[model samples]
Target: MENRRSRRAAAAAVALITALLTLVGALTAPAAAAPPPLPYVHGGQTVPTYSYADAVRESVQVDTHLDSDHDGKPDTVAVDVVRPRTTTRVPVIMEASPYYSCCGRGNESQVKTYDQHGTILSMPLAYDNYFVPRGYAFVAVDLVGTNRSTGCGDVGGPAEIGSVEAVIDWLNGRGTARYRDGRTASPGWTTGRVGMIGKSWDGTLANGVAATGVPGLKTIVPVSGISSWYDYMRLDGVPRATDYPGWLASAVNGRPAGTCDAVQSDLNTAGDDATGDYNDFWAARDYVRDASKVRASVLIAHGLNDQNVFARNFSRWWDALAAHHVPRKLWLHQEGHTDPFDIDRGAWMTMLHRWFDYWLQGIHNGVMSGPKVRVERAPRQWQQQADYPAPGARPVRLGLGAGDGGAGTIDTGRGSGTVTLTDNPNLTETQAVGDPNTARADRAAFLATAFSGTTHLSGTPTVTLRFRSDKPDTELTAKLVDYGTAARDDYLANDLSGIENLATRSCWGESTADDSACYLDTTEIVRTTDYGVLSRGWTDAAHHTGLTRYTPVTPGRWYSITIRLQPQDQLLAAGHHLGLVLSLSDEENTTPSGTGANVTVDLTHSTLSLPVAGATHLGTATTAPRLTGTAPAAPATRSTPTRLLP
Candidate 1:
């Protein structure tokens, strides 16, 4: 009898195994929601980062406390400041942008306070990597609710501000550590100067800390930063409806289990509106509104063709600083957000060194002597400006007619559109065979599509869209395309709509499957910026159909808008073509979405504001220099300054 029962159990086990195997086989394809497991060895600890000569090894990650109101449930914050082998105590420029380090660490998790440390990147190449080896104390702080951080994550609010001040105090108060004695192991800043550097979220925080107007904050580099969240993720002051829900979910879910209770909808556009009266909550956070409060010398970098965040964000910051007569410099490129580190590492390192020396080392390299601005004149060539966005440039309007709108520019308007892609939202192009990786991938369809007859239009393109929606609120997105790539075209970029891929660690982190939208620094580029829907790994096509599009009825109710698809400062030489497509909604990375409009998207007042780089100094920028004969490679070993460690 016992043997019979055992046989029955064994039979059941075999049946279950068979079922699971069948299921897995049926789904052998990629798991859309699954992310790769964390790697055994971190990519860091081997490569040198900006702030360290060797991989840093501290005895234990320290946990700091942010007791803002002194309630027993202390607001938990954690930071590790690696002072290295310095001669004396050092002043610190702390910018905790939560750059992907604290994600998987397991330390101590608590109610109001938590502390963890799993987020190490392709090495400690995050911001801390840049600060640690430069003889300054490099610290990565988890404010309130990230990693094993304690309290509730305030989402870059007052909590971050308080925690930042707290960490500064903690460093100042610590007498010694196992690695170095604070009093004896620091030369500190020779000038007692503290500075901040970061891009994107970190960049925003980098500027935010300065708003407190803290003393000793000598300089700030807000790379790809914006003045306001509304401006960054919304269009016309409307939080992106399609992408906001997923965005809020991604950030909140990153917090410890119980610290945050807000569901995805809680922070959706509706939820945000329910909580606030107007865009007031967003106004207080705008950088321009508080630009006057910042006293640090600033260097602003932006990409002119940045589809993510419009140049308007950086313009606001630059404009505000100019109004206040604040000392600032600007750098513009024609790529996506931050300059791609993997590909543009060498140039970035050079840029970093020049910046740090001018600010930290007090070197007289005449670093800020010129306009201190740089714009990519053309392929592999960049030009300097005393003030960014040089003065010779002005907007020249071009129009398209109701004809075959191939690559040329013509006068356009007085026409109407009735069709809508409330359903179809896939991009128009994909990379051609044998050249899929190039920028030509997005223009899979046409060099020019005829709306009427073939109209010979000239110059760069801009679309002046006069649109209205049925919904009370809406967002309008436009993508400018130039079909056909030369054998060696180097100026195209894959602009990602940040609306979709909000989560999917597979895209943001080191997952097995790769994504295209997340990283968009294609060749023939200059600079980049960040903006709406917010970016992570946007590529989910399903969610795109969730958009709510409206139609226009009344006259003058339309939102008359003009979008600069191509940079005005260029010479359109011959058949190197351009095209513009309108979308009430475009795809996001993981948060893929589409337009739902049945309205008329009249190209009524649309025209290209082309800044023709005619035959002269500006026109010279049109030349795309070919990679010449082989250049000699450096020796196997080379020496870089300690500050340039990463």
Candidate 2:
């Protein structure tokens, strides 16, 4: 019996030893890594952990009609894309720009990067660096005729719009896309939804594309974009400063001048340099005229004082969108020709992120439920409202006269007077206000009595002059100014002038090995104890008959012309005065008409009307006591502005 029990114990011990050996093997052996989460859901706030280094980097060449190189085959537009490493399909955010190849983008001017074999490594502007990890594809397209593309840059013409449309078509499997080596590129990983965004010229492309009613485009965000190329170059059928179309085409084409000499010549002639009338060239590029074709939702941002693209571009576009009942929002600021990212990065990013997530991912995050318009109250102060131009703004006419209470008199009463001013090419805006004690023949000045309380001007103002010109055609310019004693933000002069020392450099968002991005975060300097030109407007007296057709004025015939100033949203402080400065020409910015003429105004029937936000009646107070306020700081060293290429 003892021998049988010992044999059974030995068998049990062998089983225990086998179990221990299996456990040891499992621990020592390397385990397989877990698979990535599948089927990424849209509108999810949690960012996925995808390796950016392993992200897909590629370029696609789409076909276009522009034979920029004069090759037999159709020219190609280069589209460089950076997307997530995952296989899940996602929407795209594209920026089609001519400046990508030459001037670059942002404050530091970063250009596209390529390898030795001409493979694109990265595109400009850190959009990919931020959105790729969030399951989005960032596409930087080289406008036809620029960079590695094979077309003559038309500077916002058919080639520009058609080339970008091809890319959207290719993504949706309606067109073709090929790699640099001529191999077919399959865009099966994209969800066929695209949102085009850009600032300045880039933004102008967005406006043009949206106006085409492209299928795949879901939305557009045009910052400081132009609605009409003609407006950018001319105002009221008159050249603003230079021959913009020909000059811009040459500026973007960085190749040998001989390569595009033919195109440039065509531009010069087609531009109608002799007569500043609207022709086929300007008609084809007017997006506002084609606003009916815009199906995609829009979110436009522009500075109120942007002289480069001007506020008229956005205001006119907004009016069209409203008429069409298109979904749209606006972010109007006080800075001049600047990006919101540089002014308020945190808020801009938050709003932009939410905007994309809602539009692209179909996230119902209440973005559409929010206010449709947000306007800048001051330099950095912002306010939200239901609509723009404040809702119920009306006009109040201020008559001009030649007597003591006449010049600078802005009231409802009509007065009789005759004032003559000649063209002065050398007259500065400061001098255009005219000496209060003396009369100047070079300009005419009319000032309103000091305000007794705060007043906001929220809409466009008009100056109707019943005057007779001594010449066949005359150049008339008018400026609206806020003459106050306290310090105010000089948004005009400080926009491109703020110099940031590297000592003040700061980083924005997550950084990667490929792109180490840092931006200048600083407040724009303010100029104290000065006058701010609220708005400026100009018109060719000949265009009053009709913008398209010129009606040469018979010399000495009295003609009534209405010049509309750029719209504004500004507060006139207590005791501050409003100045209406009229001159024959603006030497600093306007074209020299060379046709010297004396403009005589008949004050009896002429008036300047201002649209004050809430005033039902025009109030005049000459003895209003000045409100007390602290003095503004002295001007600092003028900072160099980081010029952005359009």
Candidate 3:
């Protein structure tokens, strides 16, 4: 009887202890959602189970300088966001642009739209529809002075950079935003990691913001973007395209016509188009100058034939990034002022997807491995390389021989002679390059032996000329052309509209009711030509001293200077001849020199060194043709003979 009573007491005590432990466990359990996965890699690829209609849509008013309305507070930058409806936080992809509310984005010009209840129905491009479903937030910011933001559109000024920084701060819970009813909001759903991507002006903002060394920004993809505002508006101490600052400002600022006049006036005064040299104003806009501040990895895509945002912009930026030891990638194509979406759609999307996923999602996807550069060897034909200015690109000098009449020989022998050309402001590049025999008195041509095998020009060519000018300042233009009988890619003329027929339309990524993920995959158009310009360089003899200062030339003294043409990656077939043309002015691209100077070239001291890939022997002369006269010659019926080197 005593043992039974003791056993019952022990059992009751144990049961009581178990009940107490269960109650304590229930009370101490976590009330918040589970933490994100460690090394968030594999999960980043899994599509999130979330409804687009139920996704969170919000806006933030980031504080910036220069309140155009005389408001007591600084101007507010409008940040529109769309993200998956998930309890767990996710990374963000943002694009800051002055065109979000206006001219739209990409070839189709898609803009942002809002629903009846003030919820965002769609965002520009297909980034939101595609990435939001893959567990990332999409933020679109309307640059100051455009859209709902307040302030003057200071084209790439402090206000623009500040607005971007503020938005980033807010995303990381360091700043503030408000709802329509005045309720405060925060990026509560964001993981604080960010990636920026865009094209043209939008990409320019990416370059600017990344240069700021903003804390949360992890990577940037600037496609066809400018690194220096001065490079865009001017070229080597000469105004580039006319009405640059004024026209560009007007195009970006969609506010009342005169609302941002004060800002416009400031831009005009600072740009100082008459004198094309670096100043304090341009210094403020130069992201390349501030590249040391960049902490984010960079991926740059640019077209070699892009006239708007020249490839030099990206090349310079790439050099700076490499110098700073920042992680970088490049996609140099053979198109003009275009997005990679139309060039190689599938590959572009894949690369971008992997890029963002690896950077933002902590994915160890080996994206940084493999080649760092993808160069277009031919139209839409890409070749991967470990680095740019491709390895083994040795400088091959084509020595200029004495002038035989208006024409000259480009060979290994140093011969004596001089060729003089008068400066004509109205003379066009077409007139100078069409037919060598028809070249005007304003230009001089030098011919090189044809290639025996396929040859590649992989980098910038330096034109070292020993010349004398008749005036204090004169403009000189150098063109490298591939003289051949074939159809040349007319990159500048072909439009991106692809096939206009509806049947040819196809979707990429995901689509929404307001915006289609579809685009027309257009075929590139080609034009037959006797010669195609491979590369070009321009300089003002005065600016040759330095881009920041002008040095006048002596009328009759010989001056030796090197003009480095824009970087290029062109392939010449076996029959193609390498032709070098020197002219007084490049009226087609820049403002006319109008200096009326007669430029004379001293042939013996001049040499052209091109970065030719896989060159063995210097080309041998197979044909010695007579030089064209001062007057235009009759149109030729057959192709001219071109020599080759083995």
| Model 3 lDDT per residue over 217-298, tens place | 9999998888988777666676765556656666777677677777677688777766666888889999999999999999
Which candidate wins on TM-score?
2
For residue 498, model 2's alpha carbon misses the true position, in angstroms, by 6.2
Assess every candidate by TM-score: 0.60, 0.88, 0.87
lDDT of each: 0.42, 0.76, 0.76
Q: Rank the candidates by lDDT, best first.
A: 2, 3, 1
Q: Write the per-residue lDDT of candidate 2 for residues 1-646, one digit (tens) a residue.
A: 8989999999999999999999999999899888544444444552545655677889889876556556567978888988888778889999998887688887667788887767777666667766777778888998887887777777788878888888888888888888989999999999899999999999999999999999999999999999998777777866765556767887888556587778777877887756678888988889999999999999999888777787889988999999998899998888777777767777887778778877887767777886898888666678987777887777887777664422445556674577887877667665665344245778776766667788878888999999898898878898887767655555546445222324476664445666654666756545565466789888888887767877778789999999878888877887677777788777555564657888898978888888877853346533212222312212322232212245
RMSD (CA, angstroms), candidate 1 = 26.1
Model 3: residue 6 alpha-carbon error in angstroms: 48
Off by over 4 Å in 3: 1-48, 65-72, 116-118, 437-439, 494-503, 620-646
Ranking by TM-score: 2, 3, 1
Clashing pairs in 3: 450-643, 498-522
Q: Model 1 — TM-score against the truth?
A: 0.60
Tens digits of per-residue lDDT, candidate 1, 1-646, equal 9999999999999999999999998789665787432221123121222324342333222334544323456564545444445344444555564543333210110112112433222223333445445444445555455544555544445665656555544454432212213223322332356667666666667667776666667778776666666555544323334435334334634464543554333345432532122244455456677778887888777655454555666766776788887777776664545443422445665566566656754555566776657765333456665553445544445443222221122332233222222323443212111121122212211112222221222223445645554443333444444323322112223222111122222111111121111232323422221101111111111112221222223432555555433232222334333344344443331122233433344434544344433222111111121221112111111221111000
